[model samples]
Target chain A: MNLSRTKIGAILAAPTVVYMVIFFVVPSLILFSYSFWSSESYRVVPDFVFTNYLDSLHSAVFWKVTINAVRIGLTTAAISLVLAVPVGYYLVYVSRSQTMLYLILITWFSSYLVRIYAWRTLLGTNGVLNAVLLQLGIVDHPVDAFLFSSFAVTITLVHIYLPFCILLVTSSLSEIKPDLIDAARDLGTSSLGAFFRVIAPNAANGLAGAFMLTFILVAGDYVTPQMLGGSSGQTTGLLIADQFRKTGNWPLGAAQAFVMFVISIALYFILVSLGRATGLIVKRRTINPKGI
Target chain B: MRKIWSTEDILQLHLSRRVFLGGATALAGGVALGPFLPGSAHAAGGDLQIMAWEGWELSDELADWRTKNGVNVEVSAIGNQDDVTSKFSSGNPPPFDAAEYNQGYSDLYIDVLKITKPLDKAKIPNYSKENLFDVFYDKPTWYRDGKLHGVPYAWGLNALVYAPDKVEKPASYTDLLKPEFKGKIAIVDDTLATWPLAATLAGFGSKFPHLTKDEMASTFENLVKYRDQARVISLTYGDAVSLMVSGEVVAVLIGWTGIPVETAKQGLKTEYTIPKEGATTWCDAWFMPPSVDNEETSYKFINEAISPEIQAKVVTRNAAGVVSSKAVELLPPETKALFDYSDVNGIFKAAPLLGIPPLKSAEHATYADWVAAWNEFKAG
Candidate 1:
């Protein structure tokens, strides 16, 4: 009744493979095919033409929105990673109790819509923060800049996805051996230097993973931006949604979405490459430093 | 059409309409409450699934119907009219028996998808053409090939709503830019809601929903003033209501008629007004999907929905005007005041209503352009 390595591997991978084929690959192929079609009035014509893509390319707003999408995605990922690394480090290296870690993780349990609306309540001009500020004499008037701006959307997104980032980074940091850090420090390396030489290189994969995940999530989001981004929150996702919903132009929406998908993949590789280069620097510093 | 009629005319006209609703109500009530008829082709009991906006069910009425008829009536709140198209276009055999969407979406529902059957005239004997306002009942806009495919169930105006204590009575959309109202205004974050009203205020009342790009650009240029004053571009009806309830905004542009009703429940006194330039209006309709099962039940429910009792509940509780002309007679004085309906002509004069723009047609700027312009406007 013993299974071979290959057979076991196949058995383990079979479910995921089936799931992706049915859920991801099939829908993606359909979406890709739709990108090549055109819409006459509200009805989608399945004719293969480059009109949708051509139209998207010709429009300046598409490019502007696409660029804004990437900018916001990258910004959100960078901020989330920056904030997450410290928390991840503390949880893995300093914190002894699982209670604190679980408390932080529990934040994710709240509904996404509730979390977004909570931010809406907090940052609104007449919201709690403004009232408190006014009462405390911090400001004479309620600040209008706190909500319905890109600032509000970014801050909300960072809070929403921070738990996931911390989880990923902590998972990677936990895999590092305590002996490796002790060894580096024992070799005349400073705590900071050892961290750069040993810890950061080991944690690069998790950091990159968090970055990519946060980027994709933030970039494709329409609700957060639509709700909070009063005037400045027009992302490619919103435009794409408008196509399907407001315009009834499914083909154009599909085309816009695929274009973004391609951009996101390209940005992900660039992040990966940047991670590799950083890892190489750390490796060279620890193993083949010019001064050492 | 511009001439105003006397109150007597409305009372006289409403009498016949009330009689029709009374007869239909009795017939529907008998069928619903009585034991199942032996020769009926469609069975009486089954799930009646509906996709609609919030407050469509009128809980008391639904609970009463369910108790009497032994049928489960389930309603799922849809976000917008586009969700209706998504449900239909995903594939044939729509998920629900019926859907509630804007009357103007008939082009997409009836002409484009053909998922709707031409409504059976005999099935909904309560529906009277004279009961509905002319702006919404015009079939060339809502129907194709002269076949009626939907029944207007709910109607409301998109206008400026203001907090009376916080701001002066806003007589026009231009007051959104008053220095005193600065940073205390919210506008709807929608192209259809924003642009039509903006165009009208920019002195393009007759040309609204058909504005040229130059005209739209100029209108948006004017909109920038209001945008500067606005605290938020509310994304939905709830968003607008929240802005008022939270005291984030003293006034809202493109506010739905229901906003004041919701704010009042929150203990905030607010007023909705169609400005001097005019206001835009929308209608929610119920149409059976192509794959509708329990067809008999759907028809019966549609008929019952327009009955005097249900229509009264819809107007008072839900803050919507009933399509049935007779529903006005059944409404309490306070409920009637909410709609500003002293008479039928007053109801008709609520606004120089704007219809849904032809997004799919080439006669106007494409939907993409309108949205893009909004983004650009917001960006600035």
Candidate 2:
């Protein structure tokens, strides 16, 4: 019952490779092919044409919404990471409590829709926050600006995604040995200096992963933006969904999706480059967590 | 001699492996793609499949029907109106025997997709006998090319729903912009219902469903004020209900009758009022998709849907307006009070009907144009 090295490798990779090819690669290729097609009379016509892309490029709304989506994504990711790092660092380094971390992460077990609606209740004009603010005399009147805006969308997304970011950063931080920090301390470096030089670079992989995951999730999310974002917060995700769900304009939707995909990839590389330049990540070195 | 592999031999091995993988992938793809390949309609036989909007299925009646007839009815609750027409048009064997679509989408369902089939009068005697609302029977919207493509099911209006305690009953759509309602109002996020209602109140009712660019701009100009005064633009009946129940939104401009009915059930003092300028009424109807596999069952389901018993149940459970006049008789006194049936002769007069116009009707703007204008309004 011996297997060759190639056979063993194939067996180990088969499930993932097959799954990706079936679900991701195949659907993506179909979507790519559709991007070049056209729709007439609410039917997807299988003509290899450039009209959809041309129309998307020409439409001012398309670009505005696309840029809006990216802006939200970047803002959400940065804020989530900034807010999560300290919490994650505290849990791992100071508290050393995985139980508390798990408890925080467990809040996500509730439905996403429920969470979004909960935010709506808390942020609406006559909502809990407004009531509290008014009663405390912090505001003379209930604030209409609290909900149904881009700010509400961003705030809710940050709150929803913060736990995930914390979990990712905590996983990364836990791998750092205390002796490494002690060694850095023994070398006459301050705690902040040791954190920057020894800790941050090693946690770069997890940070990058967390940022990308949050950014992509926030950008592609249609429900939160539609529910909380209201009129002001409409994003390209809603447009794409409308094409499929309401308009039956698959080709144009596919093209818009591809455009967003291209923009996301470009932004990802830019972030990676920035990370590298800032000395947060070093080139040609595996981020071995145990030591340098 | 020990065998040594040449580049050609290695290439051949790699090619063989790749070919095997490719074949497996192709087989998997073919199996997946088989269900979606389009085909012609066939007569529906035994198992009944229905696709309808949420709360339109009349589940208790369906269970009773299932018990008596020994037929299984599978219902898919659609989220959007476009879903009804486009779903059967796309799927092979066409997923549902019948679908419930808004009459507003008749152009897409009957004219564009041509997916709806002529109802067999023999199977549905109740519809043929005009037992339903007079407005629905043989109407051009439901009846086209001498074929009865649809039968009216349930109808409702997107009107003003307000908490009577917090706000006085809104008399007009223009009440949305009142100084009192500033920062206390909400509106639904439906362009079709909201636009016409707005246009009517703005003294442009005659120009509705076909407003000129200037007309649309003016209508939206009025709407911008409403939008500014609003707390949130609700996406669904449930969203509005949640807002009303939580005391977040004291009033909603485009709130559905169903929302107040729901909120009232939750013990909120919510009341729906048709504004001075008539609210837009939308109706859902049962129509057979082209690929019906259970024609007998579909017709039976439609017949049962409009029957007094089922209609009363649906009205009570879903708070929907039934098409059948007989159903109004069967309704409990409390339920009957919810709907105004006094204007038996004037269903359209009570609430202005909005649907796709006939192909010959000259219109300055299409639904797409209206959507664009709405999007501009929303974007602002």
Candidate 2 lDDT over residue span A1-292, tens digit each: 9999889999999999999999999999999999998876567788889888888788777777777788888899999999988998899789988788889899899999889988988997768999999999999987877787788999999988889888888888888888899999999999899889988887887788889988998899877877887676778887787777666778988998998888888888898899998878766466565677
How far residue B366's Cα lies from its native spot in candidate 2, in Å, is 2.9
lDDT of 2 by residue, B93-124 (tens): 46688888877888778888788888876678
Q: All predictions: root-mean-square deviation over Cα? A: 12.6, 11.9
Q: Calculate DockQ per candidate and list them.
A: 0.40, 0.27
Show pairs that collide, candidate 2.
B44-B293, B44-B294, B45-B293, B45-B294
- Among all windows of 10 consecutive residues in model 1 chain A, the one with the lowest summed lDDT is A280-289
- Collision pairs in model 1: none
lDDT of 1 by residue, B1-380 (tens): 69687999889779979998998998898779655655464445688888877778655766777677778888877776677777777656665877787755666667667878777766776776665555446356456567668877877777788999988998877777779888788877655567777777677767877777788788888888888888777777787888888888899888877888899999999988878777676777788887888788888787777776788887788676777776788888767776655454565555443455556655676555676787677655
> Where does the lowest 10-residue lDDT sum fall in candidate 2 chain A?
A282-291
The whole-model C-alpha lDDT of candidate 2 against the native structure comes to: 0.79
